[model samples]
Target: MKNNINIPKEKLNQAVSRGIEKGRQEKPMKIRNSSMIIKRVASVVVIGGISLGLTFPVVVQAFPNIESAIIDFVESVLPKSYSNKLKHESKKNNIVISDGKAIVTLENSTLDNYQFIANMIIESDFFKQYEESDLEHNLYANLEVSIGDNKNIVGWGAHIRKIDDNKASLVVTADVGDIKLEDNVDVYIKLQGLEIQSNEWKSNDIKELKGNWDFSFKTDKVESIKRINIKDEIELDGKTMTLESIEVTPLASYIKLTADENISDKWVFASYKIVDNNGKAYRNAQIDGHTDEKAWNFTIAIYDDLSNIESLKITPYTDEQSIPSKIHGQDIIKMTTTMDEGSEVEDIIVSRPVEKRDLNVDAKPAHKYEGEKISYNLNIDKEKKFYTIDELIGKSINTGDGTSVTIKDITVNDKNTTIMLKVNGDYNVLSQVVLFDEDMRDIYSGIYVTHKGKWPSNSHWNNAKDTHYASGLATFIIDKIDVNKKYKLAVPIQKEINLNSGHTMNINLK
Candidate 1:
């Protein structure tokens, strides 16, 4: 599969070797597992497109003045791997503006329906005194968008490359939904508050610097786009999930998915990939938003050439709903007692859980707890793999909200505890599952599988499974559970509507 792509020969050889080694080490997987593995490798190949030598089509179209030196600027701002993927061409609109403390020169900008990307240069006394690392911690570009009379602050990220003691080049970007140029709209950006103070990277850290350098621009041109509708549905377990449409813009691709209304079982459509006629696949980069009731919108960064994209494949995920039963201890017997400095085992009585029951909300057991507390005593000489759980228990939980989740089972050992969850509500419950001790500090669980660009990290537990179509198990880990201390499993409450307001200013540039 690597040989089929246009990447360099040496990289292809490396990829093939890695794929083969990975395939050999994996436990027995489904028949289609090989195909999925190949697709994953293909996506990685798309990211390393520096040597592919494909011309930057959209970037070239917009930014004609992009020089070879810009490559160095890009490398300074982004990760070394992403320096090569920066857009070089864009719709050239060299608009410049300033706010006394700094001067900004907007060299070019482009709009891809969903997002706005701009190329600009900044000259300021505030930036001249800082090093690249200092600038990274201190500098930021604040952006605001106004469509007709509807104005609001937008979320944005920027990359800055220092050009000299007082100047730097930048690429600022923001995702603005459902943009229509026909509406009188304007974008305003400012570079201010340049100061450096660092500890750990906190999301809500406060800033103290006060330098006001601003730039504002508007575009009258709108690319004519036609969205393609592919209303397709996949059904399983008496539920239906639908793929509503695919919007392929010049910059990226968008997919719309909707779960059938009023369905009880949580449907996860995890697999969203675009396959070209040549079999090259593109993975999703970020989510746009939830467009309607039980509907989601997502975007894919089409970094690779998209001349031959044929269709989008939406695969259904498999569900794991039952827990495994216990096994006998004597059937797995091996011995070698580890003697502590002054301790010795006179007689060993191996014990296991004699009873199990499913639990409901409020910690009520569905059945009476019979016999001893569920446990297993291990033998020292036996390999850890040989020691297995002798009892399994499940529980059902209501998330205070209307949603409810089922704790299909739990297994604990000296090393870690694994909790398997099955959401029985209309929404995906995996992202909402939080495990905390009585003190309420968030515990860090080992990341088994995390989908890139997921809003909350580890939102999708099974990358191999089609998450949107089926409910897959979520496994959480903790070193050990204390029988005396209280533990709670919860999904923090989220506001359905934002009621807070922010400051806004209307500045006119002559």
Candidate 2:
């Protein structure tokens, strides 16, 4: 196996600081030096805890069986939940892209069913000065990622932390596209351009820097992600709910759920809740899904510990008001887990829901928002307004200033209209592009703000070149929208766009 990124020789003490995970006792953070930076993104903070309840003494385990040496990276940035699985694994790369002014090298790398990830080490004296600059927003990486000849699996990169004074580590993750990797597949990355921003990270981007960094190599290794068989059907308020098997890794748990066939395009669901048999509550569900005319499948990832969990008590909720057994919902699903006596540390097992359970939360709800990783509290419209997903579906408005907002996905329940809005181009100008009613009021129950998007490939690429992007979710009042009528959208900040609706006018979509 040819390594594309190589770690430079250095003492272990020359490392950067990482934020500690809340509420968990974690082992010491390790550092490893290496090469390259970005198809990067929002900072992904891994959440997990150490249970110390292992039935037996366990040594630090690797993914197992593979021969590629798990080099001590410049920083072992793997999430605590997955630290055991990925701690010792890293791709030793030798390919370096340098334009004489800067360098990008691929270092620690791993793969799963979702995408490929690599730690990119970058060293540049000029760029390192941004850490002390008066500007809060200084740099951005524009990259293109490809996997085994896929037409468009462009990846995203992110800045993890500043290491030594001359170096910083970046992580780039690319979607797997429709193709599947078997034994081995070649991967490629290109740093098309480097951008700069003077305002907030969401501000307009200016491509002021240029560099040539490209690396590619082939390897047969993949992170050990396991799927256990779990099949059960339960009846929800009005639809059929099926519980599929869960995908487990040292990083997190992906719980698979399916709704009844041909459910309406817009639907309602009880917010889900899960707890360990020990009464430890798991809140804040992160959701991803597939939607079509006949199928609606969802994968919910729980970023926490799953070991020592004799069983899991799963419950569904509409909101916090109906909590602690006053649930108009059904019983919790008590699931049994399985594992070989001595499997690899990465090989965790979770069995099917063996029986129904009743979980009661004793404390007040601690989690704020549920779906998207929102930063602030959105004021709920309070009115139980409903809207169909088709009202303004697929509509978009692009300003001449390079700022645009697209209506990505929408779901309506008896209580609110949740819209997934994708903002592209200039980030600072997002406050100007507002969704409104005929009266031009910013009608929303609560506004879910988004910044880095956690770099999930769930948004659109517009079949265009790489640039800065952000997204959000907003819930609205008004029982439903009149899909039969035209809707007005505004970009009030860009008044120079010359609109017929006057200076405060909005772009109308029929």
Best by lDDT: 2
Structural RMSD, model 2:
23.2
TM-score of each: 0.43, 0.44
Residue range 318-402, candidate 2, lDDT tens digits: 3322111111122211111111223222311111111111011221221321222312111122231223336456655443234
Q: Please list the residue runs of candidate 2 whose C-alpha ends up more than 4 Å from where it truly belongs after superposition.
A: 1-77, 81-90, 125-129, 132-135, 150-157, 164-166, 174-179, 199-207, 223-226, 234-237, 260-271, 283-287, 316-510
lDDT per residue (tens digit) for residues 381-494 in model 1? 222111112221344444322434555554455444555555443323233233444443323232211112211122112211112211123435444444334444433221
| Best by the TM-score measure | 2
**For each candidate, what is the lDDT?**
0.37, 0.38
Q: Name the weakest run of 10 consecutive residues (lDDT summed) in model 1.
A: 44-53
Candidate 1 Cα errors over 4 Å, as ranges: 1-67, 72-90, 133-139, 146-152, 183-185, 190-192, 195-199, 202-208, 211-214, 220-226, 235-240, 260-271, 291-294, 316-510
Task: Predict model 1's lDDT versus the native.
Answer: 0.37
